[model samples]
Target: MAKKAAVLMLILFVASLLAGCWNRKELNELGIAVAAGVDMEEGGRYRLTVQVVDPGQVASQQGGNGGAPATLYTSEGDTIFEAARRITQISPRKIYFSHLRLFLIGESLAKRGIGQMLDLLSRDHEFRTDFYLVVTKGTTALGTLKIMTPLEPVPANKLFSSLETSEENWSPSLSVTLDELIDNLTSQGKHPVLTGLVITGDPQMGQTKKNIANIYTPTQLQYSGLAVFKKDKLIGWLDEKESRGYHQIHKGVKSSVVFIPCPEGGKVAVEYIRGKTNVKGKVVQGQPRIDIQVEIEGNIGAVGCKKLDITDTATIAKLEKEVEARIIDFVEETIDKAQTKYRVDIFGFGEVVRRADPKAWKAMKNNWDEEYFTHLPVAIRADFVIRRIGTISDSFLNQTKE
Candidate 1:
């Protein structure tokens, strides 16, 4: 009987110990974070900005007239953790970050190196690996969060939606999630790239505009260029033309248009619908040789030259060659500059080499960038097909000429 009593007491003791709760935080006691920004502050400290959405306001504004768009709150500390902890003192509730959509790292911070900031994010339990990591161009991280968007009730949503559309169109820039960036940073023969955003005009461009046409202008968002990186540091930015070339080489371009200047003092616009690139490599006499084949299908959207009859097979063939030549020029320019000027393997060419010849990669893996890319031989071939002309059978310009 005494033994039975002892067992019951032991069970009671264990249950009582487990039932005790400490440091329990209620949902109402915390402010949920949707977007976050990290920037460099004066005196070598970090400034952390957070966008928190009010649930009351969010619930009230369903389709239109949403609650106070989004509120921006900021804090500063010696370190990222310290800055985040300081947020609690000013904010009525603790900050929660389980639903973060985007993380913006300032230009200055990016140049200094994102390796350290990444360490803090990786250690945090609330940060999800799937959230996007973007670099701000020509602006501070806090400055980007200041603008309010007109279309989606919040500016951040507009920015996030632009990323989705970029994938559908032929844009060289790529969006990297926290997980993907970490993988590339840690992986061999692979480098990381992030989509870039620049804040142009004020958010309320057409809030009180008198002209009806001007109303739509303010609602639009502009996405331009990409930031090239060497490991974790920002190296340079690519122009729109260079970005197009990057997309072609990396097979990231979905659809875009090209305007070719004809000899007859006019232009022809070609809308590219489909494009594919294939790269093959071979080693000869201790030299690595690469061959690139790009196939493109497009339609002639506009023609200002009267001499060229696109309907005729010969004329179409000539036009196809001209388009192919233009693409080849851009591709070569991008490859040459990246190889000679930047000297970084931005096209993942090293990855191609690794996949094709694992034994060779293992042998030269230590200095692939130094030994292979510098003296690497690359051969390029391009094919462009004009699949269809516009809806009109004959050009208006041709009739005018006649």
Candidate 2:
């Protein structure tokens, strides 16, 4: 009977060891940060802003009119870590970062240098590499975060979802994650580009709850162009068309619409369903040459021209040629801008050189962007195929004669 009691006691002790909470934190004790923003301040200080979700407001079924879905907290210190820890002085609960979805850097901070910021983020155990990285254009990170969005109650969620949708359907904007940005910074051949965020309406009004209650918002957050970076520093911004052109060369385009003008009149809109780009580098007698081959297949989405016949093979072929030319133009324009304007190799051309000729790349690695890449001759070739012309073979405008 004593031996049985001993065995049962041992079992209970083992079970107790396995069952208790090891490092559990209560929900009330945590200030769950869903989004964070960093801006540069005077005297070389770092300003950190975090958006902490209010569980009661966010979960409320009354459309969350109780209050803002998230509260903004700001802190300042010499370093990001210090600034983050200082947030506790203002907040009642401990700031938690496990739920972070978006990270924004102000234009001023990006221009000064984000290498140190990135280093802190990578070393921190609380941060995950999945969050989206964005740059605020013509505004401060705090200012950008303060603006409330109408469609999405949570501003962080709005930014995350908008970036995902834009990258999938639009060619101009590119989504950069924390991991991808770090990879680009560490890589010798490539540079990083982040989607730009802008506040369209009155900045002050965006902070108030009335901004969302009105039929039309007085202020709004918009995803602007792409912010180009050389290493970890912001160099410049690319316009909509230029950004799309950059995507064409780097194979960042997934699905986008292209409008081509018809020979007679009006225009035809083609929706690119699938596309791929292959960049090859060759060195001959010490001169580097690049060949970019693009394959695109799309369907006609809208026919604005009345005279164009969708059923005719010749008409389709002509439309295909126009699309091919447009694709080539996009690639070539981007290449020219990267070479002459930015003088930055955002296309990973240096990597292509490394793959094609490792010996030559080793010799040119140091001066690749400045000396070799800027002067490299590029050839762009696009092959575009039209698969279908929507549900109707011909536009109703053509049927007016019938």
Candidate 3:
């Protein structure tokens, strides 16, 4: 009977502790920051703009407060932390950063160098590292944030979701995160590249609700070229074709459409379904050489060529050859620009060399960015195969004349 009484007493004690706890903050008292923009001011001051969601309105089915779903608070200071804290003057509650979805660094700030700001971003326990990072192409980070976006209630969510989509479906747009960017900066082998966004149309209209009221929004955000960085400072940008080549070299493309012109007629669209890239780096008699081999598998999505017959195996072989040439062109063109214009090894060829032979990499490490990379010998070979030709082998357009 005494043992049974002790067991009963233990159960009661455990139940009491599980019933309650302390240190809970009400949701109403916290300002949830969905997006953050960092920009450099005229006198080198740091400007912070945070998009805080209006909880009640964001959750509502009906339009809330003239269709404004979030509120923007801005402040400037000598440091990021100081600017962040100063914004509380306009904010009703403490700014909570745990939900941050997108982080924007202005082109001006990027040109100056972003290594210092990245330190604070990583050090803060409240900030999540997975949020997408981008450099605003033509405007301040604040300008991008101020523009209203369609579909997504929160403008930040629109940018965030679109970047995710673009990374998966598009070749030119590179989706970078805080952690990945930091890894590139801290590592000696590779430089960093960030996706660039530009605000389109009238800037004044973008900040208003009418921007989202029409079928075609007056202002929209576009994911443009990749922002090339020499260490932490912005150096140049890779155009669409060059960006596609960069992705190909890194094996970063998931799915993309390629357009190849017909020999005698119109263009044929091919969908790149699967691909493999091999970057082999070695030192040959104290000289560095990189051999790149790429294998591509694709399917014909659309054929605008009236005379080309894809049904014959010989015709398919010719098309495959064309595809291979295009792939090689992309790879070589990007390498040429990198060697001549940027003179930066954004492709991480140095890292590959290090993995293959540490001694060679060490010898080339100090001058890899400018001297060695500019003169590095790269040989590229690409092979493409058409796995399928979609549902119809020949388009009905083949029956029509030009």
lDDT of 1 by residue, 1-402 (tens): 999999999999999888956767787987888789898865788999998877776556463353365777899988999999998888888888888878888888888788878998988998988778888887777777766556555556766777767756756556678988887777666566677777666544422222113444443335667677888888887777777787788763558878888887889888889888998876666556788998989999899877777888888898899888988887888878777877777777777877777777787667877778866788889999988988986787777734
Pick the winner on TM-score between candidates 1 and 3: 3
Q: Which residues of candidate 2, in runs, are more than 4 Å off?
A: 1-19, 263-265, 399-402
Evaluated against the true structure, the overall lDDT of model 2 is 0.89
| Of 1 and 3, the candidate ranking higher by lDDT | 3
47-154 in candidate 3: lDDT tens per residue?
999999988788888865655889899999999999999987888899999899999999989999998899999999999888989999989999889999989989
Indicate the worst ten consecutive residues by lDDT in candidate 1: 206-215
Q: What is the TM-score of each candidate against the true structure?
A: 0.84, 0.93, 0.93
Name the runs in model 3 displaced over 4 angstroms. Answer: 1-23
TM-score of 2: 0.93
> What is the lDDT, from 0 to 100, of the residue 387 in candidate 3?
91
